[model samples]
Target: MRKLALNDEILLKIEKPARYIGNEVNSVMKDKNEVDIRFAMCFPDVYEIGMSNLGMAILYDMFNKREDVWCERLFSPWTDLDKIMREKKIPLFALESQEPVRDFDFLGITLGYEMCYTNVLQLLDLSQIPFLAKERGEEFPLVIGGGACAYNPEPLAEFFDLFYIGEGETAYDALFDAYIANKKAGGTKKDFLLKAAQIPGIYVPAFYDVTYQEDGTIASFTPNQPEAPSKVEKQLVMDMDRDYNFLEAPVVPFIKATQDRVTLEIQRGCIRGCRFCQAGMIYRPTRERDIEDLKEAARIMLKNTGHEEISLSSLSSSDYSELKELVNFLIDEFRDKAVNISLPSLRIDAFALDVMSKVQDVKKSSLTFAPEAGSQRLRNVINKGLTEEDILHGAGQAFEGGWNRVKLYFMLGLPTETEEDMKGIAHLAEKIAERYYEIPKDKRNGKVQINVSTSFFVPKPFTPFQWAPMFREEEFIEKAKIVKNEIRSQLNQRSIRYSWHEPDVTVLEGFLARGDRRSSKVILKAYEKGALYDAWSESFRYDIWKEAFAETGVDMEFYTLRERDTDEILPWDFIDAGVSKEFLIREWKQAKAETVTPNCRQRCSGCGAKRYGGGVCHEGQN
Candidate 1:
């Protein structure tokens, strides 16, 4: 049995004692003395949240597969335990071996969201590691960063020694072997980093110098070291069906995770090509897994974890080619065992309704639709490809199928959005309520429940909207109020419920999403002033962030609320994300013109992901 890091008394004081204890089912264990490399993998969040990330589980499995490496897991302690640990001088340790992270060979932190910036500092501080990469010497573990947030790492560049700019499955093994080779040859930290910089996907920010113009825009970004590549291209697994192990036997957390179910990823990348969506652009050239392979993987996952529910994970679940077949297979396999099958991100069309009706309880389940815009013109601008008629038709099908509740998701402040667009949201919800009444009284399952939600738009890097300007906090609130009032005047007002996201949080996310190297100082200062857990609405302090930005002389408007010229050098321009700038610029022009582009399944738009030479690019060719 592995010894617990915290004593019985200390564990009792924490909210979830299962978080600190090790020896969970399916968790790997090895003698540290027998391994050549001791790597500590961290998600920089609470254990419950971190354990649910599929990327962390994939890397953990990959790293431990090596006989010469012993990889362990660590997470940021909750604020309750954080205070106690600091006062008692308890160093942060990994769960597997109960060993201090300060003693590990390499500490890799995954940066999934921008709001977790402050929590990164907490993880470093609690581990007794240097907060700045420059302060850490050869004696300390090398701190590396990766994930979607790493696409624009300049804001947090000074803190991470290196950033992996690609899929973990494609490049991690090569990077790890290179590190092992450098270590056996008696290499220093600097020497190892210098060698690691030569790898295709590895980026050592220290080797690069960023210069800003008088207008506060990136003037020049050039490499200072010979080994560092000027443009680090994003890596991807070409043949996911053959090369990728979607999800092997992962560690079943003792505490219930946020996603406490067997998550089977059906595919990678999205063909929808929504201009405002960063994930769809970054994960280009949609690739799907074989149905047989997915079935086997799901079986293994369920067997290893004993989860009663299994969710089909994907950017667009309905876009999968074999979705109907896969859903039918799952229902046939698990329905007898009383296992719940979750199918999210599906368009509420006839096929979706048919499948959902079979798998889900019509009375309890709610139908969801992402129109992404209120008016048809705004929908065209964002390339959502969802028509108002499509919405009503789908709702009609769902209502006929005994689902009385409907949820509509839209975005406010989209580029070129007008007041009419805002009112159109309420109009659409009213129409859905009308459609619910169109059903016979005896056929209706219950009263019509139409829930409408809207969030302020925040343009992200690598997307066509990357150059678009964002609304100020007050403007966002005003727009939300406009939609709320319009909903109140609806004929079926009682049936309609409207909710909007926090404007302050939206603006803050805008600042972080598009910030450059200069914004790092503001983040550092904010964290010093108790800005941890900023992702949580209750923990976020808008005044603290404003003060930090003011003190650092970093204007939030410089990053947000300003449209950039087409030729301007963005913060994330240094990395090649497979999609060409030319394609993105073309799409941006189309967005302004309100022109719709066909998806990958219909015709190739030449987005430049084809250079990788696989996936949907050659789907019809073969």
Candidate 2:
């Protein structure tokens, strides 16, 4: 529990020294004796990246608001620091108090994605705590995980003692209260975890016995106690407006983070229910806060952080009901001081462009649009409602306006995609270039630049494409090469640039995304083989993943390239995500027929979310 003195010479040798020093504006500090439950909110990455996460800020603020609880931040040290820590035997410590993470009563890790699994183990090991739940005694810190990855916690079930399945707003409060009562009774960690498992959204891994068949499928999962629910329902915050108040002022990092400026979330969830998008399915029923509240938050954030740029972020910023008014208000408020307003998720529409032109002061800022697919038929198959005309019109508007650089995002191997459909990607880019040329020279502000980025499609769970087969690495690479060759041969435009994600990396992601408990062994093995950040292409080692899969006797292709039957139970079935299986199956059928389902906000396709509703539709709300 001793505070480690800063070695200035070693700090200078490492990258981003400011990341290690965690003191910042709006950070919470409290006396350990004053709190009943001491919680360490851990993010499995460096401090700069972890501090930037809005969820961490919200939870930190909420827990500290409680007079009886104190929560602090914990992050994995960088590689150089990790080595130094091992040599010096420095235990992982919290930022606010500089106390060892092992000293906390509860260690709560917020898992955002699959890539951070290794860092979780590393963090635990560095803290001198047992990595596995069974290995750790009752005296050890209670290890719990939450966030998006917790929705499918089967893979990491062996490591975590419990999981908070959904939103933490209400569940977190319930958990801490239960812990306090258990502590008053002088209960053990096991006793407390057993009681905590009875909570609505909590899942205790120790109480469940997972049996696997010879084919590596889950045979059964039996609970040891009657207190556990048969299926844990994901917790959802009914009111987003009330929740936004919990995040009044986020901590500004000392160093430049990935998102270096103030980010105000304009809305939650997406109404355009694209079949391939996991985020849309996971965050169902789009909800927006009041525009006045958003403007006020932005103004406060700008004044506190002195951030030159403010990004209005959401799944789709253009879909916000009062986007024009929000933009105008921000522009009018910040124009005199030269603050930049950025709409991060603008849809491909004329009105969105018009709003952007009015709000964005910099004419040189690049515009980005995601058509998702090349052709209209392919787009329909993925439930991407954007038509070819929408892209053309949107690009035309950008060209007609002062903006010259346009970036378009697309996917390579979608379900039911063909070579002709792949070729259509190049054809569409050439057409956009042609449209740029058609614009008058005076209107065309500068040389036109068309940047196309293609990424391999990885089938995710809880989506319409969950049962679809992903293309093999070889096939994906071939298709990408074909698209690149076709574009160069046909259009031969110098201003147009094409880049693609590595297919091998996508194959690894595919294996992890839809994998079962058995995949955990593969992940652990790969991590031991130095797979720190597999998501980054430069750091990804395909051989390590391949070797891990081979050693574990788990077939990567069987999980990635094989389609599952509709009646089959998935690994994530035990966790209820609010969406019905019947609705997903129907959407899958529609996708196969190349039929598009309209956004639920516009029309009710009976997706079953109305069962838990504030207002079923926009008209219903009206």
Candidate 3:
């Protein structure tokens, strides 16, 4: 029996106390004395949200599979427990061993979203570790970060010792071997980091020097250490069908996670090159798992976790070649058990409508479409492949198939957006409602329910929009009003429901996303002044961040509202994310010209992902 880090008194006082308890089903446990390395995998958010991340789950299973490495898990304690623990002076501990995280050899954090920046500081603070990497010595755990946000690690560079530049499966084994060798040789921590920096896709921020221009733009970013590479390439798994690449068993949470289901990742990377999308540009040359492998994974995962619902995880599910076969296998294999299948991010064509009819309850589920922008011209500028004809055709097919509920997603404040574009969103929603009414009275399910949602655009690194300027919060709110008023004047005003995302949160995200190394102080100052859980709406404090920025002398407008020149030295130039800067520049020019580029399937744009020698780039080739 293992003693929990939290006592019964503390457990009883906190909400969802099960979050701190370990020994959940499928969770790996190992003897500490037998293992040479102890790694604490963290997902920075609350337990429920953190457990739902498939990347963390996959990496956790991968690390624990090694006999010499005993990997555990940790999450940012909720505000209730966060205060209690601080009062009691209880160090943050890993769930598996109930040991203080400060004792671990490695603490790897997943940086999936920019909003979780403040939560990282909370974790380090609770663990009793120094906030700044340079302030820590060998006695502390080597803190590292990875995920989509790692592409722009400079904003948080001073805090993290190193960052894994890409997919966890590609380079972790080599990194671990290097660490073990260094330990056996009795090498210092700096010596081990020097060795780690030499490995592909490993970046030691402390080893590099970033010099800023007088105007605060990064003048030059070069490595000071001989071991650190001048350009760190993004790593990805070329063959996703390898048995070790996909997670075999996910740890069942004691409490229901946000994603409470069996998640089967069908593929990695996206073929559609949307100019505003970061994932599409960063994860280049999409690779998919075999259908047979997927079927086996679904079976084993469902059986192991006993989850009633299984979701197909992918950027775009419709693009997977074997989707029909896999979906059919899932339906037939588990028909007796009556398992629920979730297929998100699918094009609502005739074939997809047919699949959804079989897998989902039309009455309870709503068909979703992300047109992204309103008018065709705006869509072309953003390189969104979906057109008005496609949207209406899909919606009409869904209505005819006995579906009355529809969700349409759009982005406001996009580059080149005008009043006409803003009003076009309402016009599109009304057009979809008109399609639903086209059905005969008896044939229709009931009154149509159209839910229109719009999120303010935030420019992300490595995308064509990286050079774009974001609108102010007031301007964003005014744009939201334009759509709201347009919807009110529509013919089907009663049937449509409209909601816009809070612009304040979006502005902060933009600041974090585009900021350089100097922005780290703002995050630290914000966290020091009770800025934990900025990701959660209830706990977010825009005022706190505003004050932090003012105090730290970080002009948020410089990072968010300034449109950069094509030749400007962006903070993330040091890392190569497969897509060449030349290709991105070309796409930026194409966007300004309102030209459309074909996806990976239709035509090759020569985006430099071909260097990996795999994925759609080599499909149908020798």
Clashes of each: 0, 0, 0
User: Which model scores highest in lDDT?
Assistant: 3
Give the per-residue lDDT of model 1 (tens digit) for 1-622: 6777799999888799888887899889999989989999999888999999988988899889889999999988889989998999899999899989999988999999998999999989989988889999988999999999999998899899999998889887888888889888988888988988988889998999989888888899999999999999998888988779567788999988999988898999988899999989999888888999999988888988888999999999999999988989989998878889999899878998888888876356888999989899999999998899999999998888898898999999998999999999999999999999999999998799999999999999999999999999899989989999999999999999999999898888989998888878998999988898988888889899989988888899878899999899998999999999999999999999999998888888999988887778977732
TM-scores vs. true structure, each candidate? 0.98, 0.96, 0.99
lDDT of each: 0.90, 0.82, 0.93
> Which is superior by lDDT, 2 or 3?
3
Q: What is the C-alpha RMSD of each candidate to the true structure, in Å?
A: 1.2, 1.9, 1.0
Candidate 3 — which residues are off by over 4 angstroms?
none
Encode model 3's per-residue lDDT on 492-580: one tens digit a residue.
Answer: 99999999998999999999998899999999999988898888899999999989988998899999999999999998999999999
| Residue 151 in candidate 1, Cα distance off native in Å | 0.7
Error of 1 at 235 (Å): 0.7
Q: What is the alpha-carbon lDDT for the whole of candidate 1?
A: 0.90
